[model samples]
Target: MFRIPASNNGLYLGSVPQSAAAKNGGTLITLDHDMATLPAVGRTLTVAELAEHVDDMAGRLWAAGIRPSERVAVHMSPGFDIYVLATAVARIGAVPVMLSPALEGESVAALLERLDRPHLLTDGAKLDGPLADFPVADLTDRTVVATGSRPGAVSLDDLAGAPRQQPVLLHPDEPALMTHTSGTTGLPKLVVHSARTLRGRFRPQERLASLVRKRETVAIHVSYVHSRMYLALAVLLPRAMPLVIMNDSEPAGVAELFAETRPGFIETHPNSFMEWEELVDHPRRPLANVRYFSTTFDAIHPSTMDRLLRASERRAPLFFQIYGQSECGPLVGRGYTRKNAHKADGRCLGFAMPGVTNFRLVSRNGARPSRDTPGYIEVSTAGRALTYFGEGERFDQQVHGGWWRGGDVGYRSGYGCLHLLDREVDVIPTIHSTLEVEDTVLGRLEELTELVVVAGPDQEPVPVVCTRNDRPLEAERWRAAVADLTPMAEPVQMPLTELPRTATMKIKRIELSQRLRTQEGRAS
Candidate 1:
């Protein structure tokens, strides 16, 4: 048996460190400057006080019949309130089911059903406006816990007044958080992660001591509902002070927050950083105090990395290009330092981190593995998820002998770096018999900002390009560019304002294909 680490000394999901700023009387700032920052906003809560509040909230939830292992859905926007609610659920050894407020009603209802008897904690206004129309009650034995007053719901403020009690201790392998994927392919899968898995991914033993000693102030720009939430709670919370941004995530707002908070570390999606790049025009502020900047959840464009390196005033190391699916924690990451930053072949998604994780590439034809050959990426991790909520077939196909096939296709370079290609389903096959048309095209069109090559309605290849320049490309110029590749790519080029992206910023090829089909039908 793989022995799980003790929760006392090692970082555990849902438990904040006794040495945290919230405990040391350093305030937790919710960046909501538009509205008056509350007394709780700037005033620090000591670790003891924060624990007391969590205990009180947990006891009330328990009184209301919440039990350990029960899934409690938190449906609020980013804020301190979300932090409190999530921690409260964790205190009682229950799993917090996190969902973005932006998700459609149908998706929300489906997720609730999959989680089972989910206690919905949401904004009261949303419930009355759209959520109420859904079959929320039928999905689960859900009681509406509202942040603000609305009809047919209990106020979250009332729960705080309940008696305080010691929180239940959880085993390291116990499920702590349920984070859903973006569901771009189909229904979103509920990824259940244990305390140990969460820690392994976030608080690697190598960085644990430094984090604790420094007591760094960490800023998280992604939504708290993401898998990164567990990382924040398990790893960063135990070591650093957290700055939570409440308003919509705009690049300007994020830049302003960075200026105000001056955190030592920042964790966010690559797209967020990219969007922020547009807003930040002035010379980069000296982030001398900032120790690390981590990007995850989506592909980091090479151009974005270049811009960040150029814009950074303090010249801190570009920490990691994290790669992992929701089912598994961060499987791989690579640090890009100044010495190796400009090495030409773009950024490599580094090797595997220590702990019980292994990776292999399975070929499309089920052939044996070959070095430098592209194949479906599969990972075997000590922390692999148990099962999908309802999709047994998907669960079975992907999971084999403890290894999960990540549906993505990629190759390991001679330098041992992983270079991810497009998804297996998205691979465009042409009559020219070249399986690598997409890669060839992408390699040739490196100057283009964004490109998606897909099979058009007639099964002919089409290229959709989103350029930095607004002007449309001349047809002759586009044809001449791909002239070398003849009948293989009879490319129909279209200019798009911006590529439609999923929440994670992956190009939605299926949606793009549908749009192309609609256009083709109209033309016909």
Candidate 2:
């Protein structure tokens, strides 16, 4: 068995592939789609080959005038190349600020302004689409297009074969990368991470990886801009597990790939897992080989977990649910087996990682924190981000005496499980937990593809429901499902695609609430 490398200083993304190659050069990495940056390389690669590509890209970036300590904002089209380009920027000791391609131009422009004119790496599609109205030149120091070029922009494709420079390692405490929050509330915050904090995030996940006793192909579908993507790679690569990185989350495509690869371990966004529930009954039995399934981005329904766990043919398959945010890495998590998955409570997000993470429930109004009066959840961990770029005071406001309150309000269970109720901003006075109602109703309604509870225009609880295939929801069925729960407004049925989502597929509850209010006003 391979042991995790000592990371006392921190993990440097520039050298991750190189370090992995040294341990297992032939370890294979499979991709669902081809890389736009290196189209000639094809879809399958080995760790050694991946290292060369990263090295080459680093050289091209250096040739284009990127220097240590400068910020390179990567806001290109969605693909595996996003991760490659980000690592290349880090190789030159420069900070790679990742902006989701899903972000609107206004938000992107605002973030770039906050960066104080950082270099931008984007493509033709974004420039001509959402960002069409923005003055690209004024919002950025330099615009480098990875796919198509503009007159004043630099073409990353043209920088091929530039001289490769030696890798530079920044101090462990120095800013190494920047990733944005989910932006569920409003504009996303650019979170700053040091190499040391990244190492802190890596250690707990490495321990989780150790649970697999044998070598297994690992499949991951994660947002390239999220810090979890890099940490997942860091954990799997050195262990030399065969890797499958998927760019498409379409159920049909996912089924075909999983059938071929038969990955033994899988980790993806919780919403993606919900979407993939249809694959459970596919003829290919795509999930049959999966020994472990995991989600860290959001709260997953027990029903979804049960469906997936039952699909796995492996002996005693496990589903690992980790509760975390962009500001901090995996804080608390628990694993579910087939025996208890169907009966599991969605709110009990499990306990902290034994030695690396710890959490507390701070009373909001001088009362005992419980299900009725949930307290603010705060955590103490080395994995916390340093500060929000250009918003130090905003970041400071969340940190109280070294413990970070991430705007979530929850309480600990009698047995020590952390029960996440709702985001502080999303809570409604009439409902104990909007999320809890959603979880219960969703568990009862198999037809629902998605369900979100938000405050209505009149302060009533509104349930926005999305059914599979956009089929009209049966009003009677929805009524039956929520009958035992608290009273709520008539369910608002909408297509899942129409719902506003963050890069991680989380519903923008606040935005949805406002939209509902606007629609109500328009109707009146």
Task: Give the Cα RMSD of candidate 1.
Answer: 4.7
* Candidate 1 residue pairs in backbone clash: 22-45, 23-46, 23-47, 27-44
Cα RMSDs of all predictions?
A: 4.7, 3.1
Error of 2 at 384 (Å): 0.9
The parts of candidate 2 lying over 4 Å away from their true place are: 1-8
**Residues 1-524, model 2: lDDT tens digits:** 11222444888888898889999989999999888878987999999999888899899888888888889999988888998899989988999999998999999989989999999988888899988999889988898888656889888778887988888888888899999999999999999998889999998899899999999999999999999999999999999899999999999999999999999999999999999999999999999999999998988999999999999999899999999989999999999999999999999999998889999999999998888889999999999999999999999999999899999999999999999999999999988898888888888988999899999988899999999899899888888898888899999999888999999999999999999999999999
Off by over 4 Å in 1: 1-12, 17-53, 203-217, 241-247, 283-291, 338-347, 366-373, 430-450, 459-461, 467-500
Residue 50, model 2: lDDT of 90
All candidates' TM-scores?
Answer: 0.82, 0.98
For residues 42-152, write the lDDT of model 1, one tens digit per residue: 534444555555566677777667777778888764455566667778877777888776667777888888776678877755576557688766776656564446555
Task: State the C-alpha lDDT per candidate.
Answer: 0.62, 0.92
Among the numbered candidates, top TM-score falls to 2
